[model samples]
Target chain A: EPEVTQTPSHQVTQMGQEVILRCVPISNHLYFYWYRQILGQKVEFLVSFYNNEISEKSEIFDDQFSVERPDGSNFTLKIRSTKLEDSAMYFCASSEEGLGNQPQHFGDGTRLSIL
Target chain B: AQTVTQSQPEMSVQEAETVTLSCTYDTSESDYYLFWYKQPPSRQMILVIRQEAYKQQNATENRFSVNFQKAAKSFSLKISDSQLGDAAMYFCAYSPNSGNTPLVFGKGTRLSVIA
Candidate 1:
């Protein structure tokens, strides 16, 4: 079965540095999302993207975060400045359509470690 | 706002035994979707099963099944003939049936299958 794929399974960056996490959603998927989980915490929604624009974002998704669908297949999340609290597992998910009734498929998360 | 709650933080089951994980949610929306996702040690989030709020029939996938109580806003996952591979972190998530809604996830229950 086709699945969402994320690059740089583990990323280590210095505090205050910029980091970009990349994802390649299923070819036919129309909606994409980014979520994060602090160690021992619940997974929290970050942002949702559709039609090359952000559809919705959470309070956690502040000024530092931005998402882009730079190409037909690649969706990326960039953090302008990494903080120590930013250390967590970042996950990418996608669904065939934007309607919430459809199941979203998640990728193996990228573990972001800020030093 | 929708909130998913997983009462049990951890659970253990003997191999081949049946185990149930409890999940409850508070949502104002009449139509939505509930999902159970499994994350193994690798931390790959895998969709185990999903239930549509409008459907009265329970959703089942092979050995995995759900008891969905729409009126009570309760959804529980039942794993039958549990195996060693079933040891993982299980998350209960909810999403409204709206355009591009992000999934809201519970804190998750850690399930351990003992041999």
Candidate 2:
């Protein structure tokens, strides 16, 4: 089965710095997403991308968080001016058609550590 | 706003036995999807099973099955013949039926399969 691949399994950054996490979604998938899970916390939705644009985002996806499908294969999440609380495991997921029954496949996740 | 809840933080089952993990969600949307995902030690997210809100019959995949109660907004995962490999953190997730939406996940339940 095809799988979503993410780069840099682990990342470390300083407070108020910028970090970009990159992911290559399944080749045929049309919808992509970025989610984060704080240690010992629930996985929270950050943003969803379709047609090279953001379709929906949660409150946690504020000005600091941005997602871009810069190319057909690469989906990236940029966190500008990261804070200590921004440290978490960031997962990238993709769905074939974004239908109800279609399951979203996820990558191993990029663990971001902000000091 | 939609919220996915996993009441049990941890559960254990003897090898070859059965185990059930509970999940509940609050969503006003009539059309949506629910899923159970397993995150193993490698931190790779794997889709265990999924259920559509419109389907009255629960979905079963191999030894994994779901008990979906649409009226009560409840969805539970039952793993039959649990094995040592079944030990992982299970997350219940929800997403909209249509459009490009990201999944909202519950605080995971950790399952330990004892030998």
Candidate 3:
């Protein structure tokens, strides 16, 4: 019953500052993803990574956002410039294989608040 | 682009009762996966159930089951003999291409189980 784990369950950052959200995906997973849910809004896709590179990303994942598997187990999302609209609960997920039947398991989200 | 919609913003059911949360999606791709994720007060996204578009039979897992209508582009979750723990925000999601792609989620429905 391994699970994805995220660091700093709550993060408060000043506007225009850089913030990194870290996550340790399940050990054997091959695909990783980042999603965020703004209060009262739907969960939005940010980015997906595999083979040590970004496989796909949403429009929300613009130039300001970047993801890296800096190490074997850690996947990090970095926001170069934070804004009030960037505040949300960020979730990390991983899947053994990115197949239609293989579902992704998510970590307890990191609540990010940009001032 | 694919979009998942959860029409009901909130639903309530008495303990030991049954409740069904509706979900519909708009996708042109013939092969895709549908999922239901439950988020409790802790804000952890937990996978509840899943369905493959190619499967003609509906998918069921313990007390959780899905009524999937591929033609109608509908995937609904039914919680039988609901318990208090079933109270959470339910999000219906869609994943296309069966590759390292991101999940598209619905706005989510808040389920409240009364004791």
Candidate 4:
């Protein structure tokens, strides 16, 4: 089975530094998403991308966060300025398009640890 | 807003036994999809099972099955013949029936299978 792939499985950065997480979604998938989970907390949606544009985003997806589909298969999330609270597991997911309702296949996730 | 809830924080079952994990969601939309994802110690999010809200017939895959109740907005996972390999953090997720939306996940239940 084809799986989403994320680079830099684990990353440690300073609180004020910038970080970028990358993902390569399944080749035929049309929708991409980013979500984060703080330790022992729920996984929260950050943003959704389709047609090379952001379709929707949650409140947690503030100014510092951005997503891009720079190429056909590569989707990426960039944090302009990281905070200590930003430490969490960041997951990238993809699904074949129609609405936002299809089953999404997820990546292994990048453990972002901010010091 | 839609929200997914998994009331059980932790559960344990002896090897070769059976276990059930409960999940509920609040959504006004009738068409959507529900899923159970497993996060192993390696923190890789793996898709275990999925159910369509409009399908009365539940979904089953190998030892994994789902009891999906559309009226009650409840979707529960049943794992029979559980093994130590089943130990993981299980998250119940809700997604819209359309194509571009992101998945909403519960806080997750940690399942431990004892030998």
Candidate 5:
């Protein structure tokens, strides 16, 4: 089965620096999403994109966070200024459709660490 | 707002036995979806099973099954004939029927399968 793929499985960035996490969602999937899981914590939703625009976002998704589908399969999450609290495993997901019954497939996740 | 809760922080089961992970959620929406995701040590989020609120029958995938009680707002995952690979962080997630809404996840239950 096709799976969502993320690059730079581990990322270490200095606080206040910009970092971009890249993901290549399954080829035929349309809906895209970003989520984060701090160590030993629940996974938290960040943002969802469809039709080339953000459909919904969580409060955790602040102004410093932005997502873009630069091309057909490349969906990127960019953090303008990283903070220590931003250190977590970031996961990207995609689904063939946004229907409730359709499952969202997730990537292996990118582990981001801020100094 | 929707919130999912996994009361059991951790659980253990012997290989070839069965184990159940508990999950509950608070949701006002009548139409929604529930999911169980397994995150192994590699931190890859793998979809285990899914249930639709409208469906009365529980969903089953191989050794994985769900006991969904809509009235009680409970969705639990049961892994029968457990293997070492079943050891992972199990997350319960919820989402409204709307396509724009993102998934709300619980704190997750860490399952350890002993050989």
Candidate 6:
């Protein structure tokens, strides 16, 4: 089965530095998403992307966060200024369609660690 | 707003035995989707099963089955003939029927299968 792929399984960055997490969703998928999980906490939605635009975002997705589909296959999430609280497991997911019933395929996740 | 709750923080079961992970949600929307995702030590989020709110029959996949009580707003996952590989953190998630809505996940339940 095809799977979503994320790069830099673990990322360590300075508190004030910028960080970009990359994901390659399934080739045929049309919708993409970003979610985060704090250690021992529930997974939180960050943003959803479709047609190169953000479809929805949570309050947790503030000014510091932005998502871009720079190319056909790569979707990226950039944090303008990282903070200690931003350290978490960032996951990428995709679905064949934007329909609610479609199952989202997930990647292993990128563990972001802010120093 | 939608919220998912996994009351059991951790559970244990003997290999070849059966176990159930409980989940409840608060959602005003009549049509929605429920999912159970498993995350092993590797932190890869894997889709275990899914249930549609409008369906009266429970969703089952092989040894994985769900007990979905729409009236009670409960969706539970049952693992039959558990194996050591089943030891993982399981998350219950909910999403509105709208394609634009993102998923809301519970804190998760950690299952430990003993040999």
- Candidate 3: deviation at residue B80, Å? 0.9
Q: Flag regions of model 2 displaced more than 4 Å.
A: none
- Which candidate model has the greater lDDT, 1 or 3? 1
Q: Give stretches of model 5 more than 4 Å off.
A: none
Provide DockQ values for all models, in the order shown. Answer: 0.90, 0.82, 0.79, 0.72, 0.79, 0.83
In candidate 4, stretches whose alpha carbon ends up further than 4 angstroms from where it belongs are A98-101
Output the TM-score of candidate 5: 0.97
Candidate 5 local lDDT, A1-115, one digit each (tens): 8989998899999999999999999999999999999998989999999999998898999999999998787999999999999999999999989877788999999999999
- In terms of lDDT, the best-performing candidate is 1
Candidate 5, chain B, TM-score (2 decimals): 0.98
Question: What TM-score goes with each of the models?
Answer: 0.98, 0.97, 0.97, 0.95, 0.97, 0.98
Per-candidate TM-score, chain A: 0.98, 0.97, 0.98, 0.96, 0.98, 0.98
What are the per-residue Cα lDDT tens digits for candidate 3 across B1-115? 8899999999999999999999999999999989999999987889988888888999999999999999899999999999999999999999885667788999999999999
Docking class of 4: medium
- Please give the lDDT score for candidate 3: 0.93
Q: Which residue pairs clash within candidate 6?
A: none
Model 4 chain A worst lDDT window (10 residues): A96-105
lDDT digits (tens) for residues B2-86 of candidate 1: 8999999999999999999999999999999999999999878998999999999999999999999998999999999999999
Q: What fraction of the true interface contacts does model 4 reproduce?
A: 0.83
DockQ of predicted model 1: 0.90
Cα misplacement distance, residue B12 of candidate 4 (Å): 0.5
Output DockQ, candidate 4. 0.72
